[model samples]
Target: METDKQQKDKQQLYTDKFFESGHWLLKIRQVLIATIGWLAVIIPIVITVLAFWASFDPRVPHLWAYHEGIYEIKFIGIILIFAWVMTLIFAVSMTIIQNRKRDRIVEQWPTFNPINQKERKKTIDDFIDKRFGPKEFRENVRSYTVKPEQNLETHQIQELYAKKDLDDVD
Candidate 1:
C-alpha cells in the first residue's frame, strides 16, 4: 500500500506534468509572457522616477528630452508610457486566455486521483467467495440448506433492495 506522502508526491508530479507543454515553442512563449508581465510592472515605476527626476533637475538624461513644461513630458517618456500600458493589458489578457486553455485541457484528461484497482478486485473476489462458498460445493446448492427463493421481477428486485433492512446487518 502507498503511504499518504507518496500518494501526495505522485499527485504533485501529475499536476505539474499536465501543466507543462514540453514543447520548446511553448516554453519560450511562457518565458516571454512572464518577461512581459514583469516589464509591465517595473517599467512604469522606473518611468515615473525618471520623469520626476527630469522635471526637478536640469541635468536630464540623453534618452529623454523635455518636450513641454508639463511635468517633464518628453517624447521618449510618452513612448515608454504607451508601451508600458499596452504591455500590461496584453499580459493580463494573455494570462486569462492561457488559464482558460489549461482548464479545458485538464478537463479532457482523466482524473488524477490514484485508483486502487487491486483493492477493488480483492473485495469483489472475497464477496464472490462468500456468496458461492467452497469450490467443491459451489454448484451443489441442493447438498446444503438454501434460503427461500424470491421470485421477483426487475422492478420488484430494485424495490426490495432499496427497502432492505440495514439494521439486520451487524
Candidate 2:
C-alpha cells in the first residue's frame, strides 16, 4: 500500500530520529566533559595556585629549608603542586580511555533496519544457505528420547501406534 515516496519518508524519519538522539547524546557528552573538567582540573589547579600564592610569604615555615626567600618550598605547597600534577594526569588519562571506548562502541554498532528485519533475516539466511548449506546440515547428529521406567498401559501402546499411523498417512 506504500508508495516509493512514502517509503523514502519513513526511512528518512527513522534516520532523522537516530541522528536527533545522537545529537542530544553529543550535547550531553559536552556538558559532562565540561562539568568534569571544572571539578577535576580547574578547581584543583585553582586551589593549588591559591595555596601556593598564599603560602609564598617569608613567615611560612618550610619542610626542608635550604635558602631563604623564593628558594624555600613549604610542605603544604609541595603537596598542592603534586596534587595539581596528578589531577592533570588523571584528566588526560580518563579522556583518552573514554575516547577509545567510544570509538570501540561506535565501530561495533550494528546497522540494521527494524522495519525490514524479516527481509534482512531472509537475505542473511539465504547467504548462509548458499555458503554453508541448509539448517539440517551438521557434522554430528543424534536422536534420543527419554522412556518411562514401567511398561506402558495397552491404551498407551495403541495410542502410539495410532500416532505413527497418522504420521505415515501424512
Candidate 3:
C-alpha cells in the first residue's frame, strides 16, 4: 500500500503533467488576451494625459496656427479626451460582456463548472491544504443551554455564575 505522502506526490505529478500537456498555446493565448486588454485600457489614458499636457505647455508646438483666438491644440485635446472616454466605455462594456459570456458557458456546460466536479473539488481542497496547511478544529469545551423564555445573554451569565460558584466551592 502507498503511504499518504507517496499518494500526494503521485497526485502532484499527475496534476503537473495534466497542466503541461497540450495547453501551452492556450496559456499563451490567455496571456496575450490579458496583455491586450490592459493595453486597451492604458493606451487611451496615456494619450489623454499627453494631449492635456501639450495643450497647456507653451514650449510645445501647435498642430496648426491659432485661428480667431481659438487654440487648435485645445480642439485636438478635446477630441483626444472624447476618444479616451469612448475607449474606457468600450473596455468596461467588453469586460462585462466577456464575464457574462464566461458565466453563461459555465452554466450551460456542467463539466466546465469546477464546483460540480468532485475531482476538481478534491484538487481545490488539496491545493488549499498545501497552501494554507490543513485546517485544525479545536474541541469546544464551554457548552451553554438557553431556554425559550430567557435571552441568550442571561442564560450565559447564569451559567458563568454557576461555574464560578462551583469553582469557589472546590
Instruction: Name the regions of candidate 2 deviating beyond 4 angstroms.
Output: 1-73, 110-170
C-alpha lDDT values of all predictions: 0.63, 0.59, 0.61
Tens-place lDDT digits, model 1, residues 133-170: 66557666666654555233466433433354212223
Clashes of each: 0, 0, 0
Per-model TM against the reference: 0.29, 0.25, 0.31
User: Weakest 10 consecutive residues, lDDT, candidate 2?
Assistant: 161-170
Stretches off by above 4 angstroms in model 3 are 1-22, 58-158, 165-170
lDDT at 100, model 1: 97
Each candidate: RMSD to true structure? 18.3, 19.9, 21.6
What tens-digit string does per-residue lDDT give for candidate 2 at 20-90? 64578777777798899779978756654554555566554433333442233465568899999999999
Tens-place lDDT per residue, model 3, 9-110, is 874434543357687877888889999999999996666555555567867655433343245556776899999999999999999999999899866765
**lDDT, residue 151, model 2:** 39
**Candidate 2 residue pairs that clash:** none
Clashing pairs in 1: none
Between candidates 1 and 2, name the one with more favorable lDDT.
Answer: 1
